[model samples]
Target chain A: MKDTNDWKQICSEYLANVDAALVNATVEEKQQILNDITIHLNERYHELSDEEQTWEHYQQILTDLGPVEDYAELLNEKSPDKKKFQKHRKAFWILLCAGIGCVSVLACSIGFFSHSAIKKARESKRPVVVKTFPAALDRTVDPDTTEITVTFDQPMMNFSWSWVGGGEHFPETTGQPRYDKERTTCTLPVKLKPGHWYWVGINSEKFVYFQTAKHIPAKPYAILFATADKNGNPTEIPIDYIEETKRVNSK
Target chain B: MNFNNWKIQLRKGLLELVVLKLLSSGQFYGYEMVKTLKTIKGFSIREGNIYPILARLKTDKLVVIEQQVSPDGPVRNSYAITEAGRLMLEKMTAHWKDVIETIDTLTAGDTK
Candidate 1:
């Protein structure tokens, strides 16, 4: 039925010896030769019970078959010698292809990063003005309490201040610009005269243009608002705009 | 004479010829052929050794192999003699008879 431990050990040792001796035989021929021997052993072993199939009997059988080296010589005679070199070259090609695959992946990664860095550099060179507070045009507000705050998509550098039509009619005072930790939001503390309309603009051409911490330049953007009367609480109402802020383009 | 060595030499000369003649009657696998030949005293051979000779016969086109299901439900290699094998066996048999007859005549004259 099943091969005994001794039988299996004998067969394994014999096949290993045969394989070592068969240097010039193809792998397929070696396997077939081993299969034939194994089948012969199995057929003989099955003719007797496990108790009667001794290692001595198996040894005698192997001896009667003659030396395994002789068998290997016969197998080599039947197989071609050129296939050994082909198998060696085939292994080398697999290693070479694996190396090429790794290099291709590394090159693609470098290319992708270079493209991204170039794109980021181009975008950073152009300034963008995002939003302004008190976004009103010709509207009423309490100027004394109104604070102008601007939010940019990215952080900006602190710039010098200038206002048109605000010094004479409005309070002639300007406070330092306070920025958040991100520096994206800038608060301009200005004291204005009540019930007056003012057109305010900030840009590098007329005022001082700001650059980001990374040294990207910013352009001019404006807000228009009208102050509230003395008895009016402009903070109680939302600031409505008659004209929306327009896109800021490079000068 | 060392019995083992004598048997080895004897079988080496006549084994293939005898195997092909046995198969000329009907197909027989390695184990079956060994069992049949074991009936003759001093003709014993390891079943393992039969396969190589069978392979050689097949290479020489004297035998063809087939598979048959054994009673134990396992497939076994069955060897049958080809037309070429029968013709070769016939010639070998005639030559074997001549050699035996000549040897017998010489021995009989020596006894006289």
Candidate 2:
């Protein structure tokens, strides 16, 4: 028959004492005692007719005799001295891994902001600096020729830009020039096939360091920057044609 | 004789051996086995408990089982030890004797 109160109450109250006292009893004797208790409770429970009274009587009996869990604790007096310590270390490792992940995310955010701050300082001293430019840009692709533009953190003025070098392999060295109030705003349009690549650079040639997109030259190209003082003295930053590097698909 | 709780004073672990030695003698039904077993004062046990052991021994082929119709209109399976069981019984007997001798030697004055 189903029990009204959970077995835990029985285990908690009487199991330990019973197990200790009855350790010498045969298996059958122990089973018979448990069986007796079950039958006794069943009879009282059915006779009471009142569910609450039945429940109370059952619990009263159980609260008097503890269960196997209590007895097992006594039996385990010989168990480990290391299990407790191992439990602590295992908990620590889980917490440590969680801490590392949090630290990594924080470090990544700090690194990103620090790099941005350095870039701003570098840009402040220069009249103009180029961030990126086209690789060996193709010289002719009808409309396939991609435009190479220079980007700056701030605006620049009084400058002209030109690109040269259109050769089958350096023979058709065609050159063109363009002008704008701002070099950062100047866009150089060129025509090139997809396979024909070219390189171009931006240089104000003063107070600012110039960087070009150095990559495998599809078809070698260069940019000329002419920034001058109060006079019309052109300081030419010779956009020399660098040879194309072979494209290695590292991936 | 505190009746020494047959369970408590029955030479520690020799209760099963005592049972085995009895079974080695001849075939007997559950009630008969218990009746005979109780004759040895401290060896009293629930007769039903032997049924499970008998079932186990029969399955192990350590004991053979044969059923006879009882007046109750039901069959009673009697148990008799097989050759292997008898051999096991001999070994158990020898082992128990050695155990007692060793225990006596070790316990010395503690022997009752």
Candidate 3:
């Protein structure tokens, strides 16, 4: 029981691919081509019987239309605008490469003096753990706490991070790690169980993902905490959890 | 040359003529024209291939589009041949007949 919206979505997805392929066509030409194809598809869809108006039939119509790129090729074949666009694109790339060449030469000359400065800065700027959400070794964190955040002493590389330790003691991550706009703090979304102990290593010796923009690795730090039960009472650590931690640390 | 490639080239050349001929009968939307063309032997075409030809024909003033409202659905862009298109089709049809006659005469002995 697919609705008109579903049909429209399918057609839109196909048209988007076709639109991307019509790179050489002018904006007006692309619009005209897309409009014509949309009208064509709409007409064909309406012509179908109630029973034939299924997703399969809708897909078959596109199959009959053939590959989308072929339409781009056919439309671009005799277009005078395509020739003009190609010429402009060629000139644009030539100028872009020349500009990049000049910039590279300038960067190389400046880099001679900047290299030692950067090295000195890197040696002095090893990132430190400035703050943590659970305050490191707290014994009574809320089990319902959904995230753990760590702030750095300096702006770190936003794309790279490592919440290293594994096994049962490692918090179960619910989502990807994200960095604050300043790139100084990173948050890891996690799911914690009541009365369970958790420990996560930020950039261990083997996995040095936590690094500054200059590629200086952060000093290894550990986060350890135990969540309180529903009654707000501390519970004994499970034997299996301790065994798993030992097995993970041994590796 | 490959037979399929030969037919593809032949079909590409004949598409505008065939589309013009279809429009000469009556105003038809893009999809209707494609459906009608697909029924003819040796003229089977991908539905997408017709739009560029139609676009070219419209640009050349050989054919024009009229927006017509359908009772059951959205407004449809229907194509109809112009006076110029008819003149062009007439010449094309005549030339096509001459070519067919020449080919028939050339291959007459092969049929036997």
* Per-model TM-score on C-alpha atoms: 0.44, 0.29, 0.51
C-alpha displacement of B33 in model 2, angstroms? 0.5
Which consecutive 10 residues in model 1 chain A have the weakest lDDT in total?
A: A235-244
lDDT of 3 by residue, B87-108 (tens): 9999999999999999999899
What TM-scores does chain A show, candidate by candidate in order? Answer: 0.39, 0.24, 0.47
lDDT of 1 at A154: 76
Q: By TM-score, how accurate is candidate 1?
A: 0.44
List the lowest-lDDT window of 10 residues for candidate 2 chain B.
B1-10
True contacts kept of 1: 0.19
Model 1 C-alpha lDDT per residue in residues A105-171, reported as the tens digit of each score: 8877777545466767866665555777666353566566546776777765432123323434333
Give lDDT tens digits, candidate 2, residues B16-68. 46657778777776556755775877554433334334433454467776667
Best by TM-score: 3
1 or 2: which has the higher DockQ? 1
B1-112, model 1: which lDDT tens digit per residue?
Answer: 3444455667777888889889999988777787788787867665445655676667667888787777965667778999999999999999999999999999999999
**What is the docking quality class of candidate 3?**
incorrect
Q: Determine the TM-score of chain B of model 2.
A: 0.76
Off by over 4 Å in 2: A1-251, B1-15, B71-73, B107-112
Error of 2 at A124 (Å): 76
Tens-place lDDT digits, model 3, residues A46-156: 779888878767767776776554565566555554677778889999999999888868887877546567778876778888788876666689999999999999987
